[model samples]
Target: MSRMRYFTKVEFYNYRADSGGEKAGYYALIFFFYNALIIYLFGLLMYKTDFLERARLYYSNEHLFKLAIYSPIFILELAPLLFLLRSKKENLQSIGLTTSNTAISILLGIVGAIPFTYQIILDFILHKKEIQLEGANLWVEFLILFIFTALPEELMFRGYIQTRITGLIKNKYLAIVVVGLLFALMHIPFQMSMVNMTFMDYLITNWVYMIQLMVMHIYFVYLYTRNNNILVPIISHTLIDYIQLYIK
Candidate 1:
């Protein structure tokens, strides 16, 4: 093959369409571990460097810092995968993204967000405390949340991780559960930051919330799997985050 064709070949990534389920299962393990290591290393680096503390001290720069922290997912996961797909002349739909039913997808997102929003409202009413909004403009914050946070995350978890695992396992429901757990585990750093307790104490106290987040992950995964469209999960995920930002 020519040099250009070399990289564009779908087989270049080692994902064979005819591979046995056992092979796919092995690939899933490798993919999960690679992503987990990268994400954990990024989190550890931030902690060691006290980036979160700096963001708190220089509250005006918090948004910038947040972007800096989240950049790793793009650099390590999303970008590479996207490049490989593009090289293959593959659209996102090759990995289960579709827009044939855009209206229904959007409506599903809105409907799914209702209960989550209600829970947030209930928590605010009970606690009489809200998340602190760090930015000057709600619109700007919304864009940041959707672009930097929601887009990358959905692409990583639902688009790449869950899709790959499901394809590998040949069991959509089981893949959702597995990916959901991973999603919740990935929130550990954020959870620790939000709570003032010691690490162990925080984990203990937040166990219930973590379970809730895991279930929510399943909901988002289901949205994606149901329609084979990532946009729904992205919209639903972003809506939930936007509500959190608004309340803060």
Candidate 2:
């Protein structure tokens, strides 16, 4: 096997020239803001209201409550992209969904996930965190993480947002950085809702985590761009999240 090109300037330039890069960027921004708004509203509800309590009471099951929350958010995140795909008559392959490079993609996915996996294990060893793995519940959690968290998030950030931004921005590296920042910022509202922290407080305490997230996203972009396959990042992301559960 040969080394894959991380980026191809000519290819990106041609794509931008042919694909209406400006229009794509405009749509990307719209989609991003729309998703952000949805996330913010959901977070606000979760924070201010007894939405979780109500859902837990209604479902009478932890799994059901989680599903109730995550499923809708997943759908909302993908809704605009689905509509764009349909209206534009664009196929999944256009958004890096092809299996053409399955083996390499999977290899890169594992490679990208290694550092996070190592860190998680180290944390478990150093902090003496309990490894909680309820068999059936673990499977359910993995499914939720993969479907709702990894799949939708990678699709939105790496698949749609990053791809469009690459075309719109002249510098591919800068585009990746921009997307990384956007990816990190998108988590703010939800994190705030979860922790009940103000923006400044969250940033003050979690700045390191935010930086780590951005760096990780840059790696994800590299994997996606290297393979031209979204599966690469999705696999890595799913594995990372699933492993984190062990320490959580």
Candidate 3:
């Protein structure tokens, strides 16, 4: 229980002009690169050990990856930030984890999910394909994606990193864009490994997809800032990702 509180109860790293200097830059670098490293190492572990391949025969590889790789590292990646916040006695509300505006946040989350929902429908219509739920247990997919994938990613990116970066950069707008780019960049390494083509070929082929993800990240940041609630983006992001399962 105490360990859970330590991870879930850390305060936001707020922006103060005097604090947004070299030290902030250092922390920002640690936030992005270090988390990226954790992800990369896990991907390598899954690839080398054939855990992904073996697990896919029984379960959705995506769920397995999140369960076996992303979730654990996500917890580890969050620890130092929590320690820093704890030491400084910062307010967790600044990180957007508050229950202050519960009703409003839910409304905003549903509204924020609309455009993605529209896009998902349009894609199915254009492709002449039905949106079908695939898997042995759909609820398991939901649970994994919601708990391990959506929740952790939101907590790591929107909840902690973005809040901290906003403090460090001193320009909330630039911080959002930079964070969006980092969010996009983090996926590239594993994506490149998944493809058989050369690095240049992979880049050329996936540039559009990369742009889309970065745009999604920007939208997520927008949602987070709009509601000052992490739940807004968490719900938005989870639905967006789950809907992708229906896309061919």
Candidate 4:
């Protein structure tokens, strides 16, 4: 077997350190980089090698490269979280409580889908983007797209990674910032330089998406803690994505 090394807090160094004496961060690095490599290779296989065109969080077209990019990551997400849950049971114990608070929290989550819904709506109303409705292939395409685009992301971002990291960090707000940034980082390879004219443009663009993600993560984690199950965040994420799809 091969051993792995990690970088702490997502930074590079001239000297070697043990990533805070733990390799979890390295696993995250590997997971992320592996996905990037897969996206490129799969794009080649599909002859969609024009990866430079996408400068946003998602691709405009559906290809096998994308399908491969997400599903495996989503699958691996569950394993790390489950491992964390067992080994760090004490740490995770306080996260989500199965209490009566679940009801209110869940309601709040459904309400919190407004921002993206609003943006997508405005984009359509202003004709910034063409709105597709009732096309013979629309529903089918959407369902397939939604499953790959939304489900895997919500699963990775909200379902597993965020939850485990919060346990490790033991701070909700900090964890949100960290994981939210990661959620943004995960999108960067897809767009690279086009998403940002410079690093600042990219950071700012990602920051908007990151803020929305952070808020959603906080809200879902709130519900999870109140309700005491992973399902609340999962369902909340799914609902939000559904609204994003339908609103435009």
Winning candidate number (TM-score): 2
Q: Give the lDDT of residue 41 in candidate 3.
A: 69
Clashes within 3 Å, all models in order: 1, 0, 0, 4
Off by over 4 Å in 4: 1-131, 134-142, 166-168, 193-201, 204-206
Q: Who wins the lDDT comparison?
A: 2
Candidate 3 ranges with C-alpha deviation above 4 Å: 1-14, 19-22, 53-70, 122-131, 196-201
Assess each prediction's global lDDT (C-alpha) against the native: 0.65, 0.78, 0.69, 0.49
Q: Ranking under lDDT, best-scoring first?
A: 2, 3, 1, 4
In model 4, state the lDDT of residue 91: 33
Q: What does candidate 2's lDDT look like per residue over 70-126, in tens digits? A: 888888889889898676556777677786879998888888888879878777889
Clashes of 1: 1
- Ten consecutive residues with minimal summed lDDT in candidate 2? 1-10
- Output the worst ten-in-a-row residue range by lDDT, candidate 3: 1-10
Comparing 3 and 4 by lDDT, which wins? 3
What stretches of model 2 exceed 4 Å from their correct place? Answer: 1-14, 122-130, 134-136
Candidate order by decreasing TM-score: 2, 3, 1, 4
lDDT of 1 by residue, 1-248 (tens): 22121111132222333533344445555656676676656666556567667656655565676666666656786666676457555567755456577988888877777777888878788988665665456766777777777777787776666645644555556667887887877777644544434557877878998899789887876676556667787888888888876784
Q: Give the per-residue lDDT of model 4 (tens digit) for 1-248.
A: 01212112222111112323133434444544565555444444334445434422365544544554556645553455445445533233222323445666557555554543666766767876654444435554455445665555655555445544533454556766777667666655445433324545766666777576566656655555544444455545655565565545
- In TM-score terms, candidate 1 sits at 0.70
